[model samples]
Target: METAPVPAFSELISGTQRSAVHLEMRDVYDPGSRRFASWRSGHRENPANRDEWWNPFHSVIAEAVARGVQVRRARVVSEPVSDYVQFEYDVTFSNIAAGEQVRWLPRRRASDLALPGNDFWVFDGRLVRLSHFGGNGEFVQDEMTENPAVVKLCVEAFERVWERAVDHHDYRPA
Candidate 1:
């Protein structure tokens, strides 16, 4: 059976590229239940939406590790404020199937990228990639997507921050 086509953005360069994409987003509080609920209700604010957005990406990483897809991640463990705790991950794909892992990420301003802020969005098209603004309006979102070169630079930045980051066990399952 045929599947639906992936959406593209002006900032995002759509093509079959053997490249690494860097992504940053606000982590949903109750991703498991909330994520799935949002998907069912069409309510981005709902808890299930968080899970819907993350599980697939998590799976992608897991799969890459399993199948040897050449992927890795770097993240910022903490920020000055709770809301500022920015976590970034870089997934490099050695295998580009179906044009660069069809994906999407919602954008937020650098200042507004904080805790209880909820201004981040990310998704691998094959997985879940949507999020809601968790009621904080401190940050105004300026979003865009580019090609491999720009993405590589972002990945480098994520690596720098990741080096100083603390391991986050908050979201890890028991």
Candidate 2:
């Protein structure tokens, strides 16, 4: 049976109220992305060049925070981080500037945590947008669920990681 299309992340966040938390468990992502390629070439995202790098994703977080929604992101990464993770770390200033409370957790620190296999975004402690990706780190499909049990699992796992993760400003690439 066919499934419904997943809503865009921007659309999901646009409808969020109260809070939105993201949990990323991947060490590498979007290896084929232009931004990733730029980073590999030693190009960095300059916060001053806002118009060049700012996108709807950043705008939505800023808007959510302006509306009193708490936006947070926790990333579980391996130590001696991958190039992609390093790239993400380098560019995270923009995420912070966009009003996201970003944190990074060393993978070793999450050993006792029960985290979902895939990355996800939990909205208002209710809906979850679970992200699936191909082995090569290409986008596959997103599954949106409002099941209370699943949402609870995600919320709990995210909180556990957030509690141990280092704040973006304090995290240095290892």
Candidate 3:
């Protein structure tokens, strides 16, 4: 049997009424992405050239925030972060500039928290979209669910992380 297509993240974000929270638990992701490759080579995103690095994903987020939808992202990472995580930390200012509230939680601080196996987005506390990736940090597939129990789990996990995470502006990578 064929599996149903996963809904676009933008679509889900656009449909949100009040809030959209994203939880990223990986130290590395999407190594094939141009931005990641650029960071790997020592090129960093310049705030002055915002348009050069901005994309539709950012637009969706900006739009959501403009419409009174609170967009927050919490990342749980290991101390002495991986190169990719450091890259992500350096570039997160773009996300902040786009009106996203970002936080970082050290993995050690999350030892007692029960987090989902995959990174996910909980939109309006009603839908959950889990992101799957390959061992090499390649995109694999997305799994979306509206099951109340799963949504509740995601929401709770995100809240616990957010509560313990440090504000992006205050966090300094180890």
Question: What Cα-based lDDT does every candidate model obtain?
Answer: 0.32, 0.90, 0.90
Model 1 residue 40 CA deviation in Å: 20
Model 3 per-residue lDDT tens digits across residues 61-138: 999999999999999999999989999999998899889999999999999999899999988898788899998888
RMSD of 1: 12.0
Give candidate 2's TM-score: 0.95
Candidate 1 C-alpha error for residue 149, in Å: 4.8
lDDT of 1 by residue, 1-174 (tens): 122233442212222122233344443333334434444454433323434344444544444445433333333232232322221111122122212232222222233332222222222322211123434423333343334443344544444433443333322211
Q: Looking at candidate 3, what is the lDDT of residue 62?
A: 96
After superposing all C-alphas onto the true structure, candidate 3 shows an RMSD in angstroms of 2.0
Candidate 2 weakest ten by summed lDDT: 1-10
What TM-score do all the candidates reach, one by one?
0.33, 0.95, 0.95
Report the error of model 2 at residue 90, Å.
0.5
- Candidates 1 and 2 compared by lDDT, better number: 2
Error of 3 at 168 (Å): 0.3
